[model samples]
Target chain A: MTSIRRRQVIAGLAMAPFISRYPLASKILGRLVIIGGGFAGATLARFAKALEPRLGVTLIEARSRYTACPMSNLVLAGERELNQQTFDYKALAEAGVQVIQDYAVDVDGAQQRVILQGGERVEYDRLVLAPGVQLNFDQLSGYSRQGAQDMPHAWQAGAQTTLLRRQLQAMPDDGLAIISVPPAPYRCPPGPYERASLMASYFKQAKPKARILILDSNDRFSKQALFQQGWQDLYGDTIRWQSASNDGRVNRVEPASMRVHTDFDTYQPDVANIIPPQQAGDIAHRAGVTDSSGWCPVESVSFESNRQPNIHVIGDAAIAAPMPKSAFAANAQAKVCAIALVRLFRGIRPEPTVLANTCYSYLKPGHAISIAGAYRTDNGEFSAIAAASGASPIDATQALRQQEAAHAADWFSAIIQETFG
Target chain B: MGRYHAILPMLVLGLTPCGYAQGAPSALSQSASQAAVCSGCHGKLSGVAVPALVSDARVLEQQMLALRQEGGDSAMHRLIHAYDETQIRGIAEALASQKNPPAAQSTGP
Candidate 1:
């Protein structure tokens, strides 16, 4: 939640109640309603309370538990269990955030209310929407809701993750496994590659004769050089990747036949993980907050929807380009949004926004790669400060790679503790 | 909008140096907005190999200035540009103050 700064702001606000200048308005800051209680919503709720205990924050989530998509790849490779990635709202509730176990079916932006599936209406002075992405299964032929049951995307985690893991475990020693990656702006840029790396690791250990194939829609991917180098060092040609320029775009998938059709050819595989194209969560569409791009456009400083007033969007759903859609990015955005809202409640102008993200992808158990950046919205848009943004060096020492692996583990623990601990 | 209009004068006044009491130690008492961004990746909770920002304000400021001057499009150069000297000073002080008063343990919300 960007604790130190936020805490100071809250502390200062306490000392000088600027809102008190308006004698008649007792509570300038009233209720805050947040939808999709994942990283963004949960952190927003907690930070709002920490900044100003009197501010009423309510988080509405459809699911009982949230299994983070960040480290779920480790689960797919059987390196980590789905349980390690699972989180609930118990801690948030204990922190005085009214966590509702219900689906937010629609948002009445004008009325400032979130309508639930149960017909109950939750109203607020401000609304925050952090619904993650929704996979567009229709983009791929022969892939639908039911098809996902057989060949899971595992993009949203939980059941799909477990299904993919089980599929990998059941494949024969010499079986071929394919991971079809969609075009850019997908949930996690490095995810498919990381999954491929871990898959290679798993196969190298369990199914020595097994080969892992990556069918990608993009010409190049995040941390490409490092990933290629690691694959060569660890599994050699056992892991093969075909870029879009080389017919890597998978046009169709026949789950029934266990085959995927690219532009140039079709290949049958023992198991396939097809991550489809994505859009903002369903509710964003209902609220009319998304643009033609299928993402919610937000004012850089406040993350407030440019289409709708007082409704802010964060996380993967938000079109905060240059900042990849990641758990850390969402966590950083949540704090900025929370701070902006607090300042607005007190009738103060929102401060300049500064956001950052550090993403780590493990190559093997002891080796990892990372990309990091610090960003600011001085001109009302977020961009990586050329000086402050970069990925792990190409020719890093083995010791450095191992150190980064430890950092990755530490980052995971720290974020989880900060968000839900 | 009307409420915002009513508070502008007060906000302008609050920005004055007199708004805060004199000799109020900067570190623990400074606004955390600028410094908090660093905490996202470098704090005790973040667990990365990067050193925590919990150090003397002067020392932290020098490091930030170095990153700003010599970081050269690196992540360090980009992140440090978000603040001016005052903001950086505030951040360094806040982080320094927190070093002694252990960070709060995160538990069930």
Candidate 2:
């Protein structure tokens, strides 16, 4: 055995008396119920069970199959199929987690029970909510749940992804396609730009005369310099970007005529992807965990809800600033939370933890850029470790971009297998 | 036995003086949890361009330390700066000892 293992053994022996004196040492740990079966919830369920086999874990998901959002942009560019982005919860269920296929209507935190749509009440000693972002269609004028069908957001992936791809395919050779990006604090910071890049790549090959425009509500974006440099290098003059200061903040849309309205002008593009504003999923509001910002606040170490006790929030729904709402961040948060919950169940004080995230955005097929950061809990909040956080260099070599692209594909495959497979 | 082996290390770490005073997790637990994030990219499947986390502990620690000081803008270099030598060593040891690591690679989608 290694020296570390030997130290751990000695440490364990020293703690034996303290372990015996612990109040809950002999009793069985109660149930742990998680809502949403995405990266955060599914990973938490599996890891929590693996850590403590005695803890009963149940995963509740509204949909039987999940269409991942990370790689869905590739689907729009015809580089990937929607089926490739989809997964079922059979693997999670097979891993000894009781998987429930039903909508969680409300969470009764006082009673530690979750109410399902069909009147089923699932009780839990602890609960985790990983429900991702919900688009706020009401925030934008001339847009609603129905209007999204015509002017597809394709933000959540699935049918809308297909709709946008089909519309792009049907457009004329010289047609214009406009992608409208919402303000800051959206699901994925680099997603809209990645979509714009991939779409331009598609139009470059399929319709050489086509034009693509990006209308941004924000003045700057994540990896802006790198994306601008890539646009200049890969698809010059084919793509144009307008910031909010340049009248690019889209406030209205007429899906019937494919018209998008900004502060200064109105353009009728052949295709429009209007990504609406977003908030924590509805159940978080119902659970009384969300603050006025439409996101849940939680203790950084444990991810336990600040508004309600015994309820933890992770993933896109939680206000994990400095850590973008990406699949990688959610997966890391889930593992830390699993560790915290396991200790808490055993009547042990939870430990402050560290988390990391890496997001890769493909500039084109076999070419990609990336951003990475590490976060640590300080003074009850998560702050970025400045020395260890940055994006790919703007002047990166083509070889490095290609390698990062392969890493991006590898990342998607690894995360999919870890979460669903 | 495997399960206990994993839990005992964490338990001992949690109760140690360094872990208890400031509520800071021991380097072992912190590194073990942080290592899970690596699985999001470096899986043990074939056809993967990213290297898997299956290196010798000392070599992994040395390489990570070297990368941290290299001061490049690559993702690995930037991320490795977050960890100190102790945590890096802990991560290397934890990953090296894992019987079943976190992730696996497959083909597209």
Candidate 2 regions off by >4 Å? Answer: A1-27, B1-28, B43-55, B70-73, B102-109
Q: What is the DockQ of each candidate?
A: 0.13, 0.28
Top candidate by DockQ:
2
lDDT by residue for model 1 over A1-421, one digit each (tens)?
2111223334556554221111223553578888988878887887776666667777888777778887788887788878888887777878778777777898888977787775566777889999989999998989998998877898888889999999999999999999999998888833999899988989989999999889999999878998998899889899999999999999999998888999879999999998999999999999999999899999888888999998999999999998889888887788677777777766777767567788889898767888777787667787777655778887888876776676566556556665675
Candidate 1 chain B: worst 10 consecutive residues by lDDT? Answer: B9-18
- The Cα RMSD of model 1 versus the native structure comes to 9.9
Candidate 2 clashing pairs, residues 3+ apart or interchain:
none
For this target, which candidate reaches the highest TM-score against the unseen true structure?
Answer: 2
B66-91, model 1: which lDDT tens digit per residue? 55565432233345565677866665
Query: Docking quality tier of candidate 2?
Result: acceptable
Candidate 1 chain A lDDT trough over 10 residues, lowest sum: A16-25
Q: TM-score, chain A, per candidate? A: 0.93, 0.93
Model 1 error, position A70 (Å): 1.7
